[model samples]
Target: MDSQQPKQPKVLWLNVIVFTVTFAVAAIGTPLWAWHHGFDLAQFIMLGVAFTFTGMSITAGYHRLWSHKAYEANSVLKVIFALGGAFAIQNSILHWASDHRIHHRHVDDNDVDPYSANRGFWYSHIGWMLRDYQRNRYADYTNCRDLQKDKIVMWQHKYYLPLVLLTNFGIPLVFGVLHGDIWGALILIGFTRLVLNHHTTFFINSLAHIWGKQPYTNKNSARDNGFLALLTFGEGYHNFHHIFENDYRNGIHWWQFDPTKWLIKAGSWVGLTTKLRITPEERIEKAKATMLLTRLKTRLSVSDENQRRIQLIQFEYDALLARMTDYYAMKKRFFDLKKRRLLKKYERADLLNQLQKMKSELQQQRKTWYSLAASYSY
Candidate 1:
C-alpha cells in the first residue's frame, strides 16, 4: 500500500502538540518578545551553548556512537551525552538507535523504514512522527541490544521524561533567571533553539534525500550536501554516510565541515573517546572510481566514437586500481611489520622507501586516469 493512501494511523497527539506549540513559540513568540524586550548577549551565548550540546549529542553520541558504533567513549563522556540527548528531546537512545538501524536496514522500503524518504517530503520529514506508524515496534527495541547493555543508555531511557523536562525547561529558566531575563532565555535557548534543531535534523530525512549530489553511489536516495552538513553538525555527507555507515567520520576529507567528527577525535586526546572507526581508503577510493566509471560508461555508450573512449578509460582505470591495490597492500604490510617490531632497521627503511614510491606512483596514475576521462568530449 502506498504511504500516500494507506489506512490512516492514529495521530500521536502529544508529538503533534509539542511540535506545533514549540514551532509557534519559536516562530511567533520569539519575534514578539524581541520586539518588546531585545535579546541580550547572555541569551545569545546560552543559545549557542545549548544548541551545540544537543546537536553534538545527537550527531556524535546518538548517531555515530550508538547507532553505528563508529567510536567508543568513556563513562564520563557517555553520561554527558545521555544528558545532552535528553536535552535534544529526540527520544531515548534505545528508541532512536533502533529506528535508525531499521531505517538503514530497509532504507527505501516504505513499509519497513521508519522514515523512508520515498514516501514524499512531508511524510519522511514530520508526517511519520505525527502518527503511530510503528506502534507495534514502539516498545520492541531488539535492534538496540548493544545500547541496552550500556548503563548510561538504559539510565537515560528510564529517566528520559524527567531529564527532558529539566533540560528543556528547567535549565532555560535557570539561565533566564541568572541573566535577569527569564523570558529571553526561554525564547532563545528553549524554544527557538529546539525549533531550529528539529527542522535541521528533519532536513537530513527530507531535503537530504531530495537535494544534493550523489558522488559516492546512487544505490539509495542519500546525497552529499555540504550546506546541509553545516546545519546538521556534519551529517550532510549522506551519500558517503550510507555507503560507509560505520565510519566515525561522515565528511572524510579534512576540509569538510564535520564538527562531530572533530569533537570525537578531540575526545580521544583527553581519553574521553577511543577506537574511532574509519573505512579503508582503498575501499572508499574504489567505490568512488566504480561509481564514476559506471556513470562514464553510461555516457560513452551513446555513440560509437564515445564507445571507443570507454576502452581507453577502462584501461586507465584498471591501471589506477592496480596501483592503488599495490600501494595500500605495501602500506598495510609496512605498518603491520612495524607494529610487530620484528623488522630490522634496514628492512623497515627499505619498506618505507618502497611504500613512498608506490604512493607517488599511485598519485600519478590517479591524475592520469582522471585526465583521460576528461580528455574525451561528450
Candidate 2:
C-alpha cells in the first residue's frame, strides 16, 4: 500500500451533488417550515449536545489520542469518538489524522501541504475540501502509521463515506420522526451543526496559522489566539501545539478554553486513559526565552539603542539559561536515583529544593524578559 497512492475518487461529483442537495434541502425545506412554526428550544438542545459531543470526539480522540499519541484511551472512548467523528461528518479519524500530519509536515507548501495556508485563509479553511490540489492523497500516511494499525481507525476509514451519509441524515430523520419534528431536527442538527462544525474545525487549519501570537516558538506558521482557541476547544493555541504537539493539553494556560484538554484530564481521572505527556515547564520557558531573544535580535539589527539593550540581554539570558540547566540537571539526577529504586528521605528533600529552585529561576526569567519586551519599543 505504501508503494502507490490511493486513486483520487471520482466522488468529487458525488460530494458536490450530495452536499448541494443536502444543503439545499435543509436550507430550503426546514427554514420554510420554521418560518411558519418558529424555532423550538428542544431543537437547539439537541444541536448543542451533538455539536459538543462530536467535536470533542474529533479533538480528543482523533487528534490527541490517535494522531499525536499525546495519551491513550480505552476502547469505549475510541468507539465513542469513532461514532462521534462519523456523526460530525468530518472524514474518518484515520484520514483526518493522515491529512493533518501531512499538513504539519509540509505546511504552507502548496504542492505538498494538503491544506496549505499559503493559499490564503479562505482556501485553506474550506477550498481544499472542495477540490484536489495535492498529487499524493495518501501522503499523510507516513505520519499516521500508528493510527493505521488501530482496528477502529481502519474500520472507520473503510466505512467513512457510508457512515457520514447515514448518520448525518439518518439520525436526524429518526429523531425528527420520533419527535414529530422532522424538519427542525434535520435543519438544526444535520445541516447547521455540520456546517458549523466543519468551519470551526477548518479554522484551526486556516485562521489559526494566520491570526495568533507565537509564544512558545516562532519557527512555524502556527499561532495562538484566545478567540480562535475558544471557538476550537482550546486548539487555538496553535503555536504551542506546533512547538509541543505531543502534549495532551493545547491550552495549558490557566484560562485557555481548551475543553479538549479538560476532557483528556477528566478521562485520566476516570482511569479511561493514561500516559499523558506534557512538555516540562523548563522546556516551555526555554522556548519562550529563545523566541524573545530572536525577536530582540531582529529589532536590534535596526536600532543601536535596542542593540545595546539586546547585547546586555544576550549575556544575562545565557547566565539565566545556565542557571536553569544546572538546576534541572541536578533535579533530574536526584529523581533518577529514586526512579532506579534508591529512594531516601534525604534525597527527597534534596529533590524538592532543586525542583523549587528551577521553577523559581524560570519564573523570574519570564517576568523580567516579558517586562523587557513590554518596555522595548524598538
Off by over 4 Å in 1: 1-6, 376-378
Best by TM-score: 1
lDDT of 1 by residue, 1-378 (tens): 646766889999999999999999999999999999999787888888999999999999999999999999999998999899898899999999999999999998999999999999999999999999998896658888778889999999999999999999998998888889887888899999999888999999999998998888989999999999999999999999999999999999999999999999999999999999989999999989888888888766557787678888889899999999999999999889889998999999999999999999999999998887776635
Model 1 lDDT, residue 323, Cα: 98
- Top lDDT model: 1
Off by over 4 Å in 2: 1-11, 18-32, 139-142, 301-304, 337-343, 354-362
Superposed Cα RMSD, model 1: 2.2
Residue 152 lDDT in candidate 1? 92
Instruction: List all candidate RMSDs to the true structure.
Output: 2.2, 5.0
What lDDT does the true structure give each of the candidates? Answer: 0.92, 0.81
TM-score of 2: 0.89
| Residue 48 of model 2, lDDT score | 87
